[model samples]
Target: MIRPDHPASFLEEGPFRTEEDQYFWKALVELTAMEETNQGNLAAFVGVSQGYVSKILAGKQVPKARLRRRFAEFFELAYEDMVALGRQHLESMGYPAEGLPGRRCQVREPAYGGAEAAGRPAAGQGEYSALRSMVRDLRAREAREGTYTEIPLREATASMGGGSTETGDRTLSYLSFRTEWIRSKGNPEYMTAIRAFGDSMEPTIADGSVVLIDEGRRQFVKNKVYYLRYNGQMYIKRLVDAGGRLGIASDSDNNLLLVSDADDFEIIGRCIWTARELD
Candidate 1:
């Protein structure tokens, strides 16, 4: 088992015993540990399912280089460092890089913004026009820097238990955040905010909280919370697929349902993020 002390300890466990992906696993472990959260949080932060995270950790899968680079930068690795790490991983494994994710590029954080990095230039017509265009584009993007999409907040509440879902067609307003930012955290295009009711989900998803849901993700996945609708009521529950049946579990003791089939139910989405006020 990988521990915090060893950093890349997971590389030595299970299928990772082979050298094919030890280096990549090492880098991944380091990156995931940076946020001080468990594998589940890492999966959420990287916008993937927990099972997918497990595969990567186990050396059963190699993610696209674009994804690897994104997470690398998220963990503050310079593009140069990122590429170096990849090459080092392959070398340590003694594997040919014939088939791999993607080529590495020299990526780095911006030290200084814009043309200033090129040093001061003599005043010229061409330079003047270029400067003008750059400034214009910068201002436009700065105004929209957050890159957010407006997700409608519905008046309907997803009852954990006891409480009934409000079948109203009310969309009070919208919740906005950077499309890329939350997409990096979860599915951006399918994200929406919901109001939680009751306490069945408890500590995981508390009563009267606002939670983010990824409508694009509706598969009944283990260890991930999902929004479900059944029997004229709505709920936020975790699903466990058991052969031909579905096992529903909740953080609170009150709600647990095992069904041979949840065909009568409709899955809304996967719950990606949740926020409950202290009041």
Candidate 2:
């Protein structure tokens, strides 16, 4: 709902392209406005001067050198995630980022919370000291250009059975993995994480499993589970390519839907990884 006061044409050229830079800075401003007192509060949070924050917000500058770590830290985002935003700088400057970072800053030492802080060190310098490695990793990630990509996990769940289910439209968060780690599996950029609902797939894919989908692999592949949308509802089913037609199979021994045309349903993506809590 919040629009930028200045258009991209009016912004100064800096570390990031105009639109990308604005999204980064604007998001920070809006997200923290509720928790921070002002630009000064945010500046203090990142160990930067208020003017620096103003320049960034006004699209006059970008986080330079080690400031990236500090900025990520303020957001409690990891060095990898912060650097990922400036990937163009990485590619242009020849920064290597093979491993992908991609998490928020180290666990907050009570000062912050979230997955990053789940097992963080106790209060004080102990925690800050641990962050040095994160900063170092971030530096490497930036310098080498990350090899991993972040796949968003929409808070939405894709149904695997039980008729139909609504999908989550909002991106709740992200999960990062090594591009090399999954390249053999599929295109890293085509990846996304969605929760599974219902019991159509059951034992093979539990009702609460976190399913990783390859958005690029929409074409039917035999015996492989894929994310599909039918009748405005989403479902995950093992599909087979029968010449020009498609056949969807459920692991729960349910009946299959045989289609004479490939366009009968929408292929959201292919399931690559399935993670679920063990009872």
Top lDDT prediction, candidate number: 2
User: Worst lDDT window (10 residues) for model 2?
Assistant: 100-109
Q: In candidate 2, how many Å is residue 62 off?
A: 21
TM-scores of all predicted structures? 0.46, 0.48
Q: Which consecutive 10 residues in model 1 have the weakest lDDT in total?
A: 102-111
Clashes of each: 0, 19
lDDT per residue for candidate 1 within 1-279, as digits (tens), equals 112444334345444443335445545643333223366656777788878877775456667756665655555454345445545544554433433322111111111222334243323325344333433454455446446667777776787776466756477888877677676776565767878888888888888899888889888778688888876678888887656577777788845677645345878898888888796
For TM-score, the strongest prediction is 2
Residue 263 of model 2 has an lDDT of: 44
